[model samples]
Target: VLEEIGIIFRDDAEALALWKEAGADVKGERVHFPKGLCRSLLKTAPSIYTQHARNPDRSVQIGGNATVFAPVYGPPFVRDLDGNRRYATIEDFQNFVKLAYMAPSIHHSGGTVCEPVDVPVNKRHLDMIYAHIRYSDKPFMGSVTAPERAEDTVAMAKLVFGDDFVENNTVLTSLINANSPMVFDETMLGALKVYSRHNQACIVTPFILAGAMSPVTVAGTLTQVLAEVLAGASFTQLIRPGAPVLFGTFASSISMQSGAPTFGTPEPSLVSYGAAQLARRLGLPFRTGGSLCASKIPDAQAAYESANTLNSTILAGTNFVLHSAGWLEGGLASCYEKFMMDIDQLGMQQKFCEGVDLSENGQAMDAIRQVGPGSHYLGCDHTQANFQTAFYRSNIADNNSYEQWLAEGEKTAPQRANELARRWLESYEAPHLDPAIDEALKEFIAKKKGSMPDAFT
Candidate 1:
């Protein structure tokens, strides 16, 4: 089956050279991940430690799509008319994941906010989106940017919101600090001042764009990405032995002709590949968002790009995938229709990768006997048993005739998605918090003076 298909690997000479210049560990095809990260990963085992954040994990595989999903879904606003928007419960997330990653980037300063999902089409909203995210049972994946400066770290840390600003100081202290190379010495001190606060699973990520930041080749990018991961590991090790963290790399590239960074380009694909390798070397969870290719809708472009990224990263073993839905144009904006389409696609790939079994004693002979040498197996029980499980079966992805599709109103993916979101909201119920616990949580949030989402009502 592997021989049935072909793959191409473009060699970027410039990117490779710069990474070597940075004193990265390089081999012919794979780079020896940083030593610091490997040590930490061994200590942490199942957690993300980062000999090289992108390497595939040895014990178990993990992957990511670093999300900017916290922002609003409908008509955008820094703050809504009613103040805060409320989402029913983390049921949607909790049911789907064993753990979910959350990170607030300095990028959020530019109006990148914790946007709420107004599914109930509600009357009230929640004020801070991150707080609701914090209320979840899943762990937080906070990130810090250390670009040689501490102040830069401080600003990034400030994004984590708590009921009261004072109580949440640990939000910044644990996750944000002098933990990454992204923070040039220009702001290291300011970052550490806050780092002394707590101990949570916070990750330091690298946004190494292939030509823009690192050199422009896959090999070079791999080594360069390794060094960046090393820098992050240095911070974690200095703080404690087994610091819970993940390796992050968003190494996109610039379209030589367009002059704009092409996250949807082959560069991002290469980065995904390299990050996975790095994760394996470290024996820890790795990070890099995937499944975003189209500029507008969930068309063919999105499908191919997302599949390529997932294929590479899953092999690499990244932890906590993000940007799982609603993205367009390198994540600049999101389309609801495309998001649902992508979800369907995700289900399909998962089925395809199930891989065929060659082992004996399973019924290969029986299956053949059932159908006979020249007979069709279309109506066989074997076919019926496994048929429905193939790929993501869906109402939106009807393979029915044009007449049948039209009978369903020929509704596009977006329409289907809107209805699905509506259905999810209607079916969702608020999580049951102990009455006293609920009061405490409410009291905590009540002190914060700001807008509250009308949906909460």
Candidate 2:
């Protein structure tokens, strides 16, 4: 397919040149790879690698058996505690970052948790990157809207981790979505080049809304997914051999009648499952799945859909899970209630990923023996010892008696989640950053912002 149709590297002369140098048949912007070109280029990609956090204890290992959960990315609007959907602000972005940091199950501080439209288009990336560095010490993603913004992210990362450390380690794992239908635009390619050259990780994903971006069939979508990822991931190797890259697939089934993207559908889950297997076959880390949904609010529809998608992602052996929490309105808005709700579900998924515990304590033979004939185990010695940490307790669930629930205002799940989000924000504290590094980052941001006229567009 690659040889016949060829992938177009639009408006990028350097990318075309690199493909030409690598012996690919470069025809203008349309470059057709030799049959084994992509696969052979993927040989240098690592199967697994560590994305080091500023707090080394928070570092995550991507690929293999590991699965990392990050918050929603690239949302322009947000649903607040008042349940009103509005344009997201810088404050909202920081709050979400703080929530991710506070939530034990959310492994990485996500990029562009919500686009702060109030901030200028050119300058928002600076604030967004700073928020991740300040509010959270978890490994986070870099900007991919532009190559210079991506370069800025690398520079700021250098401030925190030092030049040598930033150069040597994979601190940022940014998202680079393919334009789909076998196309790689200059904007994404430029960012990919900057990140790849610096040895940072890039998730080369095909952002496909099936029936719209690619063929409707799951198999056809998967084929397009593989072709796009191979082209994108392989191109990273051409830029800098062994630069960490994940075979990222974001394939969603669209509503046939309305032509809107639908989430938690069976077909997209199958695509995710198949794509993970394909990534494994190529010896590259797989990235897909999230608590995705099309609902505008965090309701039953959202819950059901997110569960199906998130479950399929974990079961499919996805290494890095983006949008694992806080997605709503088909990625149009980041709902606060949904964020907390998804965090609770993420905790459950984390426990599920541990698999069934088979150790003595996990088996609980003593508890079984103490409560023979299934009389009771609640008051038993083993049960008493393990009660606190025994099961995955949900913060959003109301398991109390009906009367007690009424006394507590008969709050719905969204209500409970709203309260939890409020509590988290109220008690939140920014992670400690070195004063010198913080100052350097501020100066750099100020200088950059001053250099460019605010480009709201």
Candidate 3:
């Protein structure tokens, strides 16, 4: 299909040719991969890799049996207290960063949790990176809006980790989305080139809203996803050998009735599973799935949809899960309550991933023998010893008696989540950064902003 109808690549023709020359068959503007070419090129890609955080303890191992969770990406509006949905501001962005930092389940402070509409489009990435640097100790994604912004991200990292450290280490991992049905735009390519050249990691994702950007069938969608990611990942290798890259898939089926995109659907989950299999076959870390929902609010619909998607993500063996929280209305809005609810759900998923321990202690043969025949274990020695760590407890869930719940005003899950979000924000403290490095980052941002006129587009 790629050879016959060829993917549209809206970028430098010379660079395109270079990619084609590197084992891909070229016909005019289109490049096709021979049957075994993709697999051959992907052999050099690592099956697993480590993403380093500024705090060594916060570093994460991606791929293999490990999974890393990152928060929502590219939501333009934010829903907050007073139940208002408004254009996200810099303040809102910072608050989300704080929430991500506070939530132990979120491993990476994701890129563009919500567009900071108050900040100029050209300069917002600086503020966003600064927020991640100052507010969170976890690994975070770099800006991919432009190559220059990606360079700014690297420069900021240098200020934080020192010049020598960033030169030899992978400090920032970024998202580079392919225009689905096989097109890669210049902006994304530019950012990918920058990250690859600088030794930073990039998740080469195909942004496929099936039936819109791709074919309606799951098999066709997976084929397109595979082809796109293979081409993108190959291009990264051409840029710089041994560049850390992930094979990423961002796909959702469209609602035929309303001409809208739907998330957390069965079809997308299947596609994600196939995508993970393909990524593993290619010997690259895979990125897919999240706490996705189409609900406008954090209600029953949101809970069920998000749970379905989250469970599919864990089972699919996705290495890096983006948009793992705060997604609502099919990624158009970032709901605060939904963010907290997703974190609570992520905690549960983490426990599930721990799997059943087969150790003697885990078997608890003695405890069972002592209890025997449905006799109470609540008062047994084992129960008393392990009570604190025995069961997974939710911070935001209400598990009280009906009368106790009534006494506490009978707040719903969303209400309780909202309260928890507020408390987290109230108790948030900025993580420490070196005084000189902080000042250097501020100066660099100020100088860069001053160099360019504010451009909203």
Which candidate number maximizes TM-score? Answer: 2
- Candidates sorted on lDDT, descending: 2, 3, 1
Tens-digit per-residue lDDT, 379-412, candidate 1: 8777776676633566456588999889989976
Backbone N/Cα/C clashes per model: 66, 0, 0
Query: What's model 1's lDDT at 433?
Result: 32
Q: What RMSD does model 2 have? A: 1.0
Candidates, ranked, TM-score? 2, 3, 1
lDDT (10s digit) by residue, model 2, range 281-351: 99999989899999999999999999999999989999999999999999999999999999999999888
Model 3, residue pairs in steric clash? none
- For all predictions, the C-alpha RMSD in Å is 12.2, 1.0, 1.4
Model 3 off-target regions past 4 Å? 23-28
Report lDDT per candidate: 0.42, 0.94, 0.88
Q: Which candidate is the best by lDDT?
A: 2
Model 1, total clashes: 66
